[model samples]
Target chain A: MKVTKKTKVIRSPKRGFYDKETIYKILDNHFICQIAFVYEGYPVIIPTIYGRDNNNLYIHGATVSRMLLELEKGVPLSINITQTDGIVLARSAFHHSLNYQSVTIFGEATLVTSENERYKALKIISDQIIPFRWEEVRLPSKKELKATKILKIPIVEASAKIRKEPPSDEKEDYNLSIWAGEIPITSTIQNPISDPKLKEGIPIPESVKKLMKKE
Target chain B: MKVTKKTKVIRSPKRGFYDKETIYKILDNHFICQIAFVYEGYPVIIPTIYGRDNNNLYIHGATVSRMLLELEKGVPLSINITQTDGIVLARSAFHHSLNYQSVTIFGEATLVTSENERYKALKIISDQIIPFRWEEVRLPSKKELKATKILKIPIVEASAKIRKEPPSDEKEDYNLSIWAGEIPITSTIQNPISDPKLKEGIPIPESVKKLMKKE
Candidate 1:
């Protein structure tokens, strides 16, 4: 819950919180993270899936991946994950906003070298994509593990900005004849589609079945 | 859709594209863009709504906003927008992935100077948030315009990566008795909530009603 100068939200003080529990919930709900870093003086952002364990964030890329190489250099970076919940329609356009849950973290990512750590991080990332899928599938082999580069980023400075309430129009605009409210948004997971190349006689795993319903 | 050295996707060449239409479609479908830029020594990213006009990308912030000020400085940056469609459940953990649509662009953002251009950019942004909402509400006053800063970034280099098909497991892994497939995901706009303070005789606007059904 500690706030750092970098993680503080200046514009909307009421909506920002540096609480660890709040930040973690947002991160855990979304698998993808937009990692921003300086690459050759240009700011580059890559959307990659991630997994979380306690305070450590894990991401994997090919050993030769440019993103992984840059992350290993330990340049200070920020990772952001956001989920849009609704469109807040206001009487005035200026007051219009989004009902979203977002978390931004500033940290340093290092290449995970230890085999045990790398193995665990890999499983965590897999499970993050589809909960319990890690144990359902075959683990990585030595060659696969070697070819993959996993990085661990410690959550140092982070903040969550969430706006879930109804629209707050200007006092005078309340008299205007405009419909003002929130059109709620939600992500729905449809039924699972079996892969064409799936082996015959294989039953749909419970893990994949669980994904069909809301988490 | 011009492909520069940095905008190209190298790891999965088959999944990447540099066509203007493809990139624009992805951008148009998503409203939030994760903008990345370097500040001092740290790389920072912020989630902001954006509007596209031909080849120009416009984003607004408070005149004193750190993101806007830094962007106006003309630092090289990348904007990434992504939509996750499904969870690709593979037979092996290493091959697990997400069926996603994403676009990344590299450009230098410069502050809008002319008042006319600023006004138009603001409308484009408003409409981008909710189509046709710009005309429904009052336009910004002179003071409001001056207090806000808008930056335009030319999409000189961009690429889109989209995967919408079923999972592709390893040839040998097809023999495993684990389910291999995709759980399609979709973001749905729920029923609109009328503001508690809405004035009498005010009806729900057509724009808010249109948002109820899919576009």
Candidate 2:
């Protein structure tokens, strides 16, 4: 992957990573992403779910959604996936920062037109949200698929920025008797709440059981 | 307070909220935000921390930061703050969704030039990350303040979209014996890890201790 001027991290150059391994690692760990595109000379951002498979990223929304309609026109897009790791507490207010891993991709999305490809893309997105659940649950019917629009963006130009270390305070500020450290933050999955209309004897599915075990 | 065309939520109209109370509640709970701005005819998105005070949202960066420099030009900007509450697992893949609260603000940001306002904005940002830590930590000095730039965007044109209920499966799919529910997700603050160079006798600060207590 080439580091284009747009994908390069201008601030904190040292934290910028251009390698595919680093970019994919951050993208695969998070499901939500914010995509930016120019609309009528103004920038617009839409936060939505995304799935990455090999060198392509997929996102699906209702066919009539404004965002999906605009993106399907093959407009230039900037997508960002971020995971906040912790809050860095420094000895001074100026030095406070966050520990995070984020990836930004620059590309244009093309509408997935083929029936087979659309189905595959939808499955990839479903799997990204909950692995193995796509196989367990009912698949999308032709009517449902028709109402959804899927877009695929080639992940050729991307970069990752990461900050994982403890807070670094000014040399003199460290002696100010202030306690400085890192407060780790994590998104944890709690017990599943069954739908009120669920059947009486149905137990938790295997995919959710596996997810709980991982947690 | 007006729902301008830019800030109106076009998708899932029922999920959109225009009330200030709902917007402010979502903004007050989250600090990280993604800001989009048009640069050289292309849209660029940057993820950063922000603080909301009344009708203005403040974000700061190094004086030389590209994002700050570009945004200070008063270009139109779109900022989004999203908090994913859970993953809604439905009986069918097409119905699976995420439970989240997100607020999007469409406006222009101006450079904060006044010395007093700059200092106060920085404190609000710091307090947003960790309350009470601003009082304990060393304040920014003249040079440090000069080295940073802050931009304030009005919160007038904003809307929030939220989804908190359980998954809604199709009428026939609900009887398919598949497990359907929501996996609640929460960003938890873990125990603070003291900096390696911390003084042995210094204890954890009150701000962090209080944050942990709330968790």
lDDT of each: 0.87, 0.91
- For model 1, residues B1-215, the per-residue Cα lDDT tens digits are 55778977788888999998899898888789999988888888999999999988999988999888888988888899999999888888888888999999988999899999999999999877788788788667777787889999998989998887877766887778888888888988787888877777777787776666544
| Angstrom error at residue B55, model 2 | 0.8
Give the distance in Å from residue B82's predicted Cα in candidate 2 to where it truly belongs: 1.0
lDDT tens digits by residue: candidate 2, B57-92: 999999999888899989899999899999999999
Tell me model 2's lDDT, rounded to 2 decimals.
0.91
Model 2 clash pairs?
none
Error of 2 at B5 (Å): 1.5
Residue clash pairs of candidate 1: none
My TM-score estimates for the predictions, one after another, are: 0.97, 0.98
Task: Give model 1's docking category.
Answer: high
True contacts kept of each: 0.93, 0.91
Name the TM-score of candidate 2: 0.98
* Stretches of model 2 off by over 4 angstroms after superposition: none
